[model samples]
Target: MKKMMQRDSTWAGIFLLPNLICFLLFVLIPIVSAFVLSFMQWDMLSTPKFIGFDNYIRLFTQDEIFIQVLVNTLIFTACSVPMVIIASLLIAMALNQQILGKKFYRVLIFLPVISSNVVVSVMWKWLLVPDYGFVNYFLSWFGIAGPNWLTDANWSMFSIIFVFVWKNIGYYMLIFLAGLQGIPNSYYEAVEMDGGNAWHKFRNITIPLLSPTTFFVTVMVVIGSFQVFDIVMLMTEGGPGRSTSVMVHYLYQQAFRYFDMGYATAISYILFIIVLILTFLQFRFNKSENWSS
Candidate 1:
């Protein structure tokens, strides 16, 4: 029995060894090194010097731009997350219904999500140009003058939010569609027998059952929003007076542009904490809802 158990353990270890080695070499080591580096000061060309928590202390207390970046990140995530999630759910509901051209509509919506963010941002920059852009041209008919989107502090973040929502809705819509389909038809039949309308059916039967999916979507969206960079970089470069400067973009600027490795790593850890807290809140809410139900 002992010999057979040893053989089984050996096989299991062999099967897991490759992935475990890769993870340790690629992920765990780097993450741990970054964490350690966060507490030290280094310029890329010099030896790192231990700085304790001074980087974090400065960020929280003395760094005005850091505060602005944090505020912008929070606002961007706050505005875009709910809009994208709800929009995706609605799209999913519509697409999941028995309608003609359902497959085509799904494909059309999903294409942009998988497309390159830089490419989309560049295309939108042209499309939103004040005078010759297609969107402004259409708006000109209404006699309401269009502002410079990427260059105007007032409109820059909003413009980015709109782009983010437009690009991401399709992906989440597909997720929601899967969730909707996973729901049993028997629930709908029971609701029908109870004289439920579409609204009633969705509220009572669909939303409750779809809570798990919603929770998952919420977590992913929040995490993605925290890390948003490409679109901002391509669209505005965190310009228009830094109004659209998200945390990650600010981190990039600090590290590469300003050569502040210690500060950049500190900013990264701040973002890490924010994401961790948001994830915890999402799961806590889900757990509470589950228990209540």
Candidate 2:
């Protein structure tokens, strides 16, 4: 028995070794290296010089653009997260009904989730082109002139937020759909016997049961919002004068464009910390809710 157990353990270890090595090399090592790089001034070519806390100090105290980018990130997250959650939930509920061609509708909605971000951004860029774009053209028919979505500073951030929500809502909707399906129909029947309306059933049963899925979607959306880069880069390039400059985009510019690898790494760490804190808070809130319930 002992010999057989040892053989089983050996085979398990052999199967897991490749994945463990990849995780260490790709994820763990890079994370450690980035943390080390955050404290030193290295431009990718020169030998790293110890900068102590200068990078962090400058980012907080002197970098005016960093402050703007931070605010932009917060605004993006705040606007997009709630919208995504609400939209996804509503869509999921709608699709959960016994409607015609429900599967087809789900497939169409989820298509964008699988589409490449670069392609989505580029497509939206063309769609939102000031005068010639389909969006503005459609608005023109209603005699309402559309604002420059990607060009105007005031509208650029909102445009990106809109695109972000539209592109990613499908993913969250699928999650919510699964949550909705997992809920037993007995709850609804019980509510019906109690003379509960749709609103009461949703408020009393669906929302509570779906809290776990909501929490998961909220955390993911918040993290993705903070790391928003590809769409911003492809659509606006952090422009109409830095209106859409997000943390990741700014980090990319610092590291790749300006060649300030250390500063970029520091920015990356700040992003990591911010995301970690937010995610922790979400979990804490979920725990408290569970206890209260």
Candidate 3:
């Protein structure tokens, strides 16, 4: 029996080898290399020189732009995540209500999520133009002056946040809709037996049952928000005056534009740390739910 088990294990290892090789070559090797590279100073033209913690030390203490980029990234994520979650939740609930043309509405909303971010950003850049754009043109009727949505220092982040939220709502809404459907009809029936109204049903029954879906959406949205770059590049280029520069964009600038490989790797690790902390916090909250169950 022991020899047979060993034979089976060997065959299993043989079958897994291809996938393991691919993982090592593509994912694991790059990650390990990046970790090592973070401690070395290098330009594309020169040999890498070991610099220890100098790169990280400069990122925290000596780099003003890095600090600004961190702040901008945090603010953008903070503003965008909740807005996307709430908006998507509301839209999902409405769409799930057996309304007319529900399929059409779902497709329309989801189109933006599937569309190219570059194309959307370019189109919106025109629509958000200070004078001739359709947005400001419409605001003219209300006697309210619409600031340059993409170009103004004060409004650049807000404009991008609004567009980002709009673009993501459809995708997240589908996830929420699936969750809403998973909720058994029996739960609502039980609530009705107790004379629970809509608010009570949502507060006590919907929220608790939907917490798992919320957790999933939060994690995905947070990860995507942290990596926001393409839209910023296409729309504002981290201007007017770096008002819209997120962390990933700054990393791109450092690594590609400035050819500062060590500093870029340091910033990437900082992002990794931030993401790790947030993920841990989410799991901590999730564990409470598990314990209660």
Candidate 4:
């Protein structure tokens, strides 16, 4: 028996070795390197000089742009997370009904999610052009002159938020759809027999039952919103006077454009910390809500 158990353990180890190695090489090592790099000052071309906490101090106290970028990230996360969650949930509910061409509708909605970010950004940029853009042209019919979405600081952040929500809504909708499907129909039937309306059923049955999925989606959306880089970069280039300058985009600029690898690493760590704190709060809220219910 002992010999057989040992053989089983050996086989399990053999099967897991490749994945463990990959995780170490790709994830663990990079994380550790970034942590170490955060304390040093190196511009890719020079040897790293250890300057403990100076990068962090400067980031927090001295760097005005960093503060602005941090605020921008928080605003983006705040606005985008709730909008995506609500929109996804509503769409998921609509899609859950026995409507015609449901699968086709799902495909249409999900196409943006699967499309390349660059392509989406470019398409949206064309659509949002000030004079000849489709969006502005449509607005012109109503005599509402659309602002320059990409060029104006006041509208740039909102434009990015709109695109982000549009691009990712389908993915979150699918998640909500799966959650909705997992819910047994018997609950709804019971609610129906008890003289409950659609709102009542949703509030009492769907919302409570789908809390776990909602929590997961919320956490994911928050994290993803904080890391919003590609869309902003490709669309606005964090321009219009740094209106849409998110943390990751700023980090990329620091690391590559300015060659301030150490400072960029520090910025990355700050983002990690922010995400960790927010995720922890979400879990705490989830636990409290579960207990309360």
CA deviation > 4 Å runs, candidate 2:
none
Question: lDDT of candidate 4 vs native?
Answer: 0.96
Q: What lDDT, from 0 to 1, does candidate 1 have?
A: 0.94
Q: Can you give the lDDT of residue 119 in candidate 3?
A: 85
Q: Write the per-residue lDDT of candidate 1 for residues 43-86, one digit (tens) a residue.
A: 89899999999999999999999999899999999999999999
- Candidates' RMSD to native: 1.3, 0.8, 1.8, 1.0
**Model 4 residue 17 distance off true place after TM-score fit, in angstroms:** 1.4
Best by TM-score: 2
Candidate 1: list runs displaced more than 4 Å: 1-5
Models 1 onward score TM values of: 0.96, 0.98, 0.94, 0.98
Worst 10 residues of 2 by lDDT: 211-220
- Tens-digit lDDT track of model 4 for 1-293: 99999999999999999999999999999999999999999999989999999999999899999999999999999999999999999999999999999999999999999999999999999999998999999999999999999999989999999999999999999999999999999999999999999998999999999999999999999999998989999999999998999999999999999999999999999999999999999999999999998
After superposing candidate 4 on the true structure, give the runs of residues whose Cα lies further than 4 Å from its correct spot: none
lDDT of 3: 0.94
Position 66, candidate 3: lDDT: 88
Residues 74-107 of candidate 3 have per-residue lDDT tens digits of 9999999999999999999999998899999999
Which pairs, if any, clash in model 3? none
lDDT of 2 by residue, 109-145 (tens): 9999999999999999999999799999999999999
